[model samples]
Target: KEVKKEIRNKVDAKDVNVLLDTKADVDEVNRALVDLNGQLNLKASMMDITATLQEQALLNTTLVAELCLGRWIWKSLRTKQGGLVPWNLQTANSDPSNLVWERDRTHIVCATPGLYELSIGFFSRRRPLVKVLVNSEPVLTVNTPPQGVTHHAGGRVSQSGRYTNSSVTGLTHHDFLALPAKAKVSLLYEGDDD
Candidate 1:
């Protein structure tokens, strides 16, 4: 009779409540699993974005480095050895195959055919008839800012010859020319002081 009483309680409210509690626990676990999956997905998206940003940054840096090619700078030139400049600036001679330094003492031979920007700086109070020559031919002659002022498109001049606080007598001539392949470019700073 005692065993029968214990078996009847199994179908009563006390044991029935235990089954309901198990169902609630399972429901909570399902909700937690969904939240954890969402977190994983968010982490994956952030990683992808970070990877794409790194790739883009690398591409931009390479582009800037290429654009900096074919640039040259020479400073403190007291005398002209045939007016031929060996650009100490590394960017000018970045491509050794294209920019030939030892081929000719006065010229840089360009092996590629494309539009090139050439800049030549000199100190002359009179703007002494400076020009660009490609393959021994004149292409463009530069102009200066009025009588005693720095030009708008001129570079910063460090040597003495500052006529005024805002004016510099130095000239930075800039010209863009389409040069043919294997064409030699040189300068002519040959003029007497009058």
Candidate 2:
């Protein structure tokens, strides 16, 4: 009876309640720790993505511009003076970070000085000579040959047949040219017919 009384004194109702409350507190603390770890991992992933974007922005420093002729351009008359081709459409302009294009004029102005790839394409029903010019100086020229042939029969023994050419011709030129800041570039066309 004495031993039993000592055990009862040591583990009373209040002590048992206190032990249960302590276990509950430990479980709540564990859940909070788990949530905090998940949030830290998400923050780390976000930081990595931001760093990658910054690196890509630094590596991609090129500026590009593209101009195109309007529809029904083939119906226009051609000139032999090699005049500047009027581009009525702008397919792409610079990224605004490094270049600017004049929408009203036939010039593409560079904001950053670097080597740029210039490409020009000309399509015409007659054989045409296309020139890519930088600051009024011709850098590249493309001459498209006539496409079709027409045969004419002749009675003369020396001249049996005569061939005439007719068809649409296309010419393209690609050049890697270096330009300083504020340089102007344009395309010139010379042909007999549109």
Candidate 3:
């Protein structure tokens, strides 16, 4: 009974609202659905925020497991050496590439064999370059490309705290997904075990 109640409570509120508004005008109803869907997406995103904070705490402890890490979000292109490379990050609306988000420690799965570089950082307007060795090939490189502004931007690396631009540092092994048997992948943020 308790579990059923919990499941019902977890149902998306917008879905219920949409069902209630089923008799509304077609175009108006569609607009309302879109707005409600946006709100629902926001609610779902809040889970990621909470998960990130909780993950930061769990990482403080010595326990390691996969669920501790959130799901994989996105990946970038590989470098000339077959390493993955990173591009300047831009906020959803802003142009000229200002503001950065942190990369999840266990983010990115190598679906194929190649060198890959990951750039992890946070909300700095300035772009800083940091090179991380992927597969011990010095394959990945993080750089801020120069523009008409005449100079490079700030660095991407965060010096302190669990939250960097968007990524949570100090990850545990639990944060990573299980790789295939022949995966050339390595954990970007090695847990205490490393």
TM-score of each: 0.48, 0.55, 0.21
Could you give candidate 3's per-residue lDDT for residues 62-178 as a string of tens digits?
A: 332321222223234222233233332323322111112235322233443323233343222444343444334333444444343333243334654564543232211111223
Tell me which of candidates 1 and 2 scores higher on TM-score. 2
Model 3: what TM-score? Answer: 0.21
What tens digits encode model 2's per-residue C-alpha lDDT throughout 25-133?
A: 7778899999999898767576788999888776663212332112213223433244776545455543644445544455565665667776555644544677777
Which regions in candidate 3 have their CA more than 4 angstroms from the true location?
1-107, 114-122, 149-194
In model 2, the runs with Cα more than 4 Å from the true position are: 1-23, 27-53, 60-82, 94-99, 144-168
The per-residue C-alpha lDDT of model 2 at residue 16 equals 87
Tell me how many residue pairs clash in candidate 3. 20
Instruction: Name the 10 consecutive residues with the lowest summed lDDT in model 1.
Output: 160-169
Candidate number achieving the greatest lDDT relative to the actual structure: 1
Better TM-score candidate (2, 3): 2
All candidates' lDDT scores?
Answer: 0.63, 0.58, 0.39
